[model samples]
Target chain A: MDNIAGTKSSLTWAVHISVAALVFLWLFPTLGLFVSSFRTADQIATGGWWKSMFPSQQNLTLRASPASEQKLEGSLYVIEGELFEEGIEVEISRWGASSQNISTYAAGEVGEFRSGETVTVQANGSYRIESETEISGSRGKRIFVTAITPPEFTFENYQNVLFDESNREGMAKAFFNTLTVTIPATVLPILIAAFAAYALAWMDFPGRSLLIAAVVALLVVPLQLALIPLLSLHNDITTFLNGLLGLEGANELKGKGYVGVWFAHIGFGLPLAIYLLRNYMVGLPRDIIENARVDGATDFQIFVKIILPLSFPALASFAIFQFLWTWNDLLVSLVFLIDSTGETTVMTKQIVELLGTRGGNWEILATSAFVSIAVPLLVFFAMQRYLVRGLLAGSVK
Target chain B: MHPAFLGLFTILVGVSVCVGYYYFSNQLLDKVLFPAKGPNAGRNINRREMIRPWLFLMPAIFALGLYLAYPVVKTLLLSLSERLPGGASQFVGFDNYTKLFADEKFWEALQNNMLWLLVVPAACTAFGLLIAQLTDRISWGSIAKSLIFMPMAISFVGAAVIWKLVYDARPIDQDQIGVLNALYLLFGGQEPQTWLTIPLANSFFLMLVLIWIQTGFAMVILSAALRGIPEETIEAAIVDGANPFQVFFKIKMPQIAGTIVVVWTTITIVVLKVFDIVFAMTNGQWQTQVLANYMYFQLFTAGDWGVGSASAMIIMLLVTPILVWNVYNARKEMR
Candidate 1:
């Protein structure tokens, strides 16, 4: 029985090992993204992120001097630069004008050139040109320099992605734009919803059931159905009412209209917001509101003095969800917030264009992506304690 | 028009939350907002009490009405029209609906959507279940959970970029540089494949990206549900000599049916309007058009407002029954 049990334990261990391997296979791609963000585009293009830790020796070509200037002094036309210093072994390999046939010679190998020139490269970053005469050309000579690059990492990509003025359309602006939309977008819905939720959850009203049903029904309606018709309606409304508000025509307000997008954000955010907030507000201890009501507290006073204070966890958690959802939104912002020209492009759109232009360049993408996600991450982490507790509150109760 | 909207708007006149932040010290709310552990509850119900909540709610309602409600009405109207060039259309009742039935691309899109609705949610749930089970066995369970959950945090647009690299194809003769093609060659395939060009194969390939992203979402929710299962029930099942698989299938799963439905429906709703991934990845090209992408092309790209609105209405109508079911479930969970 002991031997049989031991064999079963080993089998269980084997099963566990295979499962662990599957998990790693699943996770490596995103992990590669995080790792690749810190690497050069060239490096990422050449090999996997696993190889980045090791030092790599790469051969590079440098144009040092002109071929015609070679006087053939001492049976050699010497063109030299500070490419190699003492104690630094700079090596040269194959050389060609066409990048297609770049790898023709081995480092430290002698070659007889078609120009009647004999060339040999050295390991110590020096080469000997034992040519009968120098080749002729007005343009500088084509020389290949191979160097061993030490393991390197830089914050330059992150800085460029995040802080460069050219990147003003970057995370900084998007961060602020996100805040502009998110703060009001979140705060407004809760303010409205809290009152409605309070009414639905606590206070009595004639149309209360109808309103609750409406919001719940609204929750089922996906936002994608609203995108185009919404934009044209916005244009029409602005046109119809631009006369009333002393505002420019609908097309003129164009991409700069935060009014349209702010409305869009709030609309999409409402039903769920009201539902979530109501669920939370409804769950608050009834005794507190009842006691407050007995102490001359009207419905308004009860909401203010008792219910709102107790509903902190729910409010905070909802805010985090609203902020993250609105911040990461591409579709709503693209249709509503984006201008006729590309001027008002948000960070998410900027990152998207960067993907189109610099698709293979992981450094630019990863750095920008990290920037785009930084706020959401920070919001999630900061209010995370409230988040799960809030959204999940109504479920268990 | 809600009483909540009216009451708050009336009371908050002149005095506002934004204004209160600056001069709230002398006011009642400074004391009321922080009652007891705060200041004592100030004056109970006063003039500001009536309008305060609605004061806050008014901007939100106005915004919701203008952006959300108006478009819904407008789309309903546009769905009946024969759209002209200058945003004008002749009202054509139900002809758009007639065209909707006859269009092959519409049916193809509808079929593909059903395929997504079937394939993606089923695949996502399976992967989520697998990961949840395997990770539950691991020592560093949260680490595994976090790794899967990490994808959930990225915007759909960001995931598209990560996938573009994974699906990137080069000439078959040159080099199989894409990860999938490279794997195929490594497995001794004769020629590199254009994974995107193969219609059914590409659909499955695109589905993988959606599956990749959503598996994490499913796992987190399901993991939470799994955690909610009572330990004693499992112990009881084990004592009955039920196998581990039996314990999972019969014992643990039946307990969390509601949570499973919630996660599945939520992903279903998300999959219905999936635009960014399909748009960014394939731009809905080569038999890749889903409803949301097709709606976008019809409306914005082709400027066919009537058909677009009708399609939007159709998507909304399709999602409605599922949503009603979900709301019913939610109410059940609530009660």
Candidate 2:
């Protein structure tokens, strides 16, 4: 449209800049979490994630080798050691022996301790403490350094959050539990809604339009309204079945498990599932169905053989939608699947619990959150076309 | 058995059962109950056609009815009656509603929800439209749109964690870890603020998380609507000396107004039932309670089913107009 008149608009740069700003504004929060996940606990605590890309100045309290490591050389008893551990490269700009004046001495300058020991610390973190008398304490002497540490990132947080076995807050079990809930929940709804959508679209029946309208109305029905009644219903059914079957105690259905959550997801997902599939199915070329009907193919056969295959895009669309929805859902899983035992917790619930317990522990929180978010994000970016297609089909005319 | 194994087993069984139900029921209609090879073949074929649609629909209907339709009525009834001691309920007309009305917390939640209703949808839609229009002519528009739309996949809890890092606070003496506080201090603020603990502003901060997630949705829908606008109409507008802004505001905007309404109401419905974000972020602390969280608190924490169901009904009531509007549109589209 801008090129139609052979005149370039001056606002083109504005358009680019505004879109860039909008995209940056949208991406910044998730980026912060993603960056924080890789940072160590001390790094996250002392600085913002935005500052993590550059080398940061940090105030560190280091200890020289313990007084027990002191060695007598001629007339002087000397304690010598590196303040930082092996392989850590930091440049100490200033050094001090006391807490009150941490930067009193520059690196490579000697500062006297309260015990009349003189300590000279190098920028490479090697320090020498010399005294005329023997150092007697078992613990190392305290040294404070103002060091400029290089930019550092680590996979240790991910290792601890996902791979560490002894960590009680590990997300490994919860990751599997999320898969357990998500697969059945996503698959069952598509099957059930597919058949229903086929019938609503192709099979001639009284009140077909009404059924479609009902599905449309149900699409916006908040799943919040379903929580209490369905929970009670599940419990009642379990009790009734247990009584009839003469089952009791631990063997009895607790009414909250994978099966209950699956059903809840199916129920919640069906309206949009049916609505999307039926809309797509209705738009399928009309003569194809008529041709199949004339060729002595049953409605079931036609739907299974022709319609299902032809509706691949629509099916893929709904599958991605349902997959993301079920995988990321917290409320339904919390109310239905996870009980007081907390054994069956999904990642989202686990992350929320971590939020409460480990609020200040951003390494754990960010790593755990990113672990849960990783799959959906992959599915989102990989099949975003279908997701957008599904959204447009589901929402817009 | 392990839950993952159980899940795999359930998927196999559920799929086979649905497929088997459709297949066996169709076979029963054809072979046994209404045999097409019989002397009454023609009549049997007609009868089977009449029943097959219902057979195809039966499982979906049962599931939907049990899960959704029945719950709406059940919740409505539970709202009017209080629970008794022994799994029984006594009829108490409007007692729950009255009790809920008298609670200050309920009023706070309702007021905050009203604020959310007023702010979230408008901000999302406006931002969505702006992004959609802005990204339309750019070279990397699709990539920009996809990045913007990426948050739609993140769960509310995940988003809460993300934004929590953004709003994290530290003491005045320490370096601020949260971006908001860091920027606050950088921009000449005296002290870092605990963004989520402040009264009125905290709600908006929470709403920012939602807006961040939902604007993606609104953008995707409205972007499609923008592309759907007729090219000739835009060209005609431009030919008539309509500047770029005028073309978008006067021409393109009018064309996609219906879609904007759809996106708005769709987001409104989402906002109405937004529980996880509030529950995860503040858990109704610091005056950030919304309706869904309030209902969950009533039902689970307080063990007040009557008021919980009442609050659920309030959400349903708010949704009813959109529901009716949608159904009406569907019916009209069918005609």
Candidate 3:
């Protein structure tokens, strides 16, 4: 006993360290995107997200006020100004009058300029150029300064991605489109699966065992096979319905819309939903169901009153799975829901388009990607217990 | 209508339809088709009891048959035919399969998918088991586990963008914006590399995203299995002077071997069906193709339904064994 306890205690520090390392490894990529979304385009382009939190040293070229703004002060033609724009905070580490020697003079050190002029640059990006002769050139003398700028972050990326009406790549409509596809996709399947699961679990049927096996088998079927056939079928049905009803332009009634996606999601989600719900429903104690039945409550009443509440964990679990799957889905919505008009495009498709069109624009890509990721991440954290419980129920057994 | 309103209307219609179907169908079955309160009450009651289960099961069966089972057969048929313009198809009889096999890009996708299959599941399972074991006795285990598991929620496109930033590259003489290039340059590499444009390594880079997402899944399931191990087995091992490694390997590992297989197969299915990551990241360029994306390219981009359906069949072929295995296990469990 002593040896066992000693060994465990000795390994505790190792366990903590390894777990921390794993967590950091997993969280780093997402944290990078999250950080990148908050940063301006210049910051994202000039430095890695890991450097976004700290003051970073940068070499910037700033000019003094233009020659027009130059003034004569005390027997000198002088130009005095801060290198950074107003309200910007930076520490000038080094300064030079020429681009060839950006770091030639130390901060607060005086350096000789062209001819009889001398300039001193302060740490706070303030500088003065004085010469007995007047300053020339329409442009002020170009001053090269190496400065350390504090970390800056903004909500502008999110605004551009989510709200800017002119940005064709904005995720605002795509976000709503995804929600339209997802809610019914998630809810329709659960309601249908719950009723079916109750029958499979508690009610007696001739082929219950076979149905259970079929559900399990269907759980592993790759949905890739469903795409082409389903699309053709939907098209054929839509054309037929249009001709029969003489509703030519109104063919949009069923082929591509929220209802189409809802049905498709139900079709795809049913096997797993039924499998999960039945597994949960089967585990419920037989006595409660039997007592209710003996007291003359119908199966529907029993399902609504007894099993529904009792199976809340299972329902919640499957809801999260379906919700996440539907929310994150690309192929289903791409094939079934979205049309060429691009009005019904979901976030996944929107992000894929951004990846192609605005591939180098990390601000847009990161912000749009994060917007799509945000809802599922929220669902994940909030209903994580049920999600895990569902995984264990679905996979482990 | 506005999509949000349309969505709300769908919820209302879908819910009411489902509720009404079950209620009306059951009512019609019990009260109309075979009324339980009739002169033949006993027979009517027995008949209703028998019919009620099917009524409950009808919608799910219709959905499953139409959505899943029918598509399997339809896709198989489509795979063997040449789809022409204007909704007509000729029975080409395996021409698509031959053409697909002959295409080098299809072969590339197959090879990369093979590499993905061989790597992602093994790496995820190993890392998952490692994390599960390491975090088992720690105080912040759940917090650590949650953080690691958080990526599972993110869409593949989102993950691709996340990793795209990580793999973003700039030429030397400029500050490196991407983390990988930055680290490479910081450690003294000549010229920052374009990570995604490289062939074999790029697939691995993409595989890294899936592995990151799946490892947490493997850990959560395996961790639960590890906890489920009977205390007596470990106590007995400890009493017998077994080391911690011995207890874990000889005792705990064998007990959870079944679950490890389960996790492996589940992740394997995910790897087999992997599309969005490659689609969003590379779209099968630079030898980063997988079958799903290749099929998508064929169907949509290239507009070849026969070849596309054939590739879809190939994915179905890969999944069939798992489907059989799961059904077998389910049958055995039921028995």
Candidate 4:
């Protein structure tokens, strides 16, 4: 018992280290984005949020109240106001001639400027600028200032991303577009796949094996090969059908819309959907299917009654996979759906547009990114059990 | 002899039968299932068993041929020609292949794709194994798996957005707005490196996105494989005095080697087909392109269909051995 406890402790240590490493590996970049998104554009430029936790000095230049406004209380001109913001601490660093070279002053000492001038700024916003003659010009007096800022964060970036109507390519619209493309693409494949899978698995077949092999072969063919030809084929078929139906010159029917994309997806997706569904369907107990047949069931009846019901888990699993994949796909949509106007642009394209415009803004990117991912996250969580749950329910359950 | 004609004939017959059965199946199903239920359902019909197979095979057979077979032949033929503007293509045997071999961009794209195939699969497998192993023992195992699998749900396009923010670089004069540069500045770096613009490293950087997406897939499949390992075999090994590491390495790993290979190959095949991430993010610039993107560039943007087709065939040719192995393995597993 003692030995076992000791061994378990050591084993636990090994597991802990591995888990820690994996977590670090998985994290970091996104956390950086979350931290970055809150920062000012300048802050993100100069320092990381992690460093912002410490007090850091920054030079701020403000014009002193005009020389005319400098009150003469005694023999001197004294201006009094607060320096920096309230509750922020500052020791007056040396003042400067220009915003660029700001470290020329000592506390309680005057610095000479061009044209025989002098200025002094104290720990407070109090200051005095003296010249042999009155200072004049449209430009106001410039004072060098310093202040310590505490760590700050805001939802402002998210606000800009989500609420700005001018941003036509906002992630929200793109998210909807993605959903528009994804749900149909995902569901269509499963519908077709389930029907085809049932036919391939349970329905007797002569070239069944050959068809399966052909699909299996297709699983290898790269989708890139099909982009143009498939589009033209789609164009040809739609035109031919429309012509036959006397819906002449329906050119608008074929390019860059949900219809075109869904069909493209269905075309590209059919082979795999059938293949995966068939793999799962073939695993169904022969007895259950046989019993339904023996009970005088037609193929469609068995498919609807016993097979669809029995195949729920596989259907669910395949649905989860297909949904996630199609939801994430860009290439299929790009070739099949992209048009001159970009009316049907999806979330992926929208994000790329953002990358080009506000590419430097991590806050906007992260917020938009998180927004884009929300649905997929929901779908994955809702459907992940299908990946592992026993599909042979009661046949082997 | 041509599969296209074969497919066409099959489609015609199949469609006719499906339409014929639209009424006929009602008669058959009523007798068979309902004895008289709905318009589509009926009772008492005679059909031979021999006809059913052909009936089922028709749609599956013909659909596969036109979609898969004809396109494949057309693509191979494309490789042997030069795609002229206005869609006329002239014969130019091996020119595309030679161009691909000699072209720097082509070589770079191919190399990047190979890197993706190598790194994405192996890293995903490793990361997945770590997550699976860690989560398996913890009380919140399901939560961990679900969290890791979250990226699986997000489109690669979506995940790429998240990562792009991380890798985003601004001008050096501007504040480091991106997370990566911000961190780099924290430690004092001068150049605000556009991480994606960095040629060679960008491949690995891009690979991380694929890894992020694939880890969940790998984990999901492998976790299933892990659960499939019998407890009795494990306990027996433990009783025989195998340590936890030994049990894991010796017993568990060996049991799931087939699953590992299947998952690895599955991802590798998908990795070879990866175009979305590259196309969306970089548009094949700064050495971030892969074979699929190259094919897209040549065929669509460049309007060189023959070269595009040639590249497509090359990709298919590259994937053949892996696909064959996959079928063999899947067949073995089915048994």
All candidates: TM-score of chain A: 0.72, 0.91, 0.95, 0.73
DockQ of each: 0.28, 0.81, 0.83, 0.29
How close is every model to the real structure, measured as TM-score? 0.80, 0.95, 0.97, 0.79
lDDT string for model 4 (A190-297, tens) is: 655666787778776566665565667677777766766667677787777777777745343554566677666656767766776777788889998788788877
Looking at candidate 3, what is the lDDT of residue B135?
84
Best by DockQ: 3
Write out the backbone clash pairs for model 3.
Answer: none
* Superposed Cα deviation of residue A268, candidate 2 (Å): 0.9
TM-scores, chain B, all models:
0.83, 0.99, 0.98, 0.83
Tens digits of per-residue lDDT for model 1, B1-335: 43233324533541366345323432454345434242333443343453444444444456556556666777888889887776667999998888777877777778888899999888888888777876776577766666665666677777776666566665666544356767787799878777877887788888888888788777767777888888888878877777778888999889978777767777788889888887777777788888888888888887777788888888888888886776565566545
CAPRI level of candidate 3: high
lDDT per residue as tens, model 3, A202-255: 999799898888899889888888888888778788878777888856444567
True contacts kept of 3: 0.87
Which wins on lDDT, candidate 2 or candidate 3? 2
Docking quality class, candidate 2: high
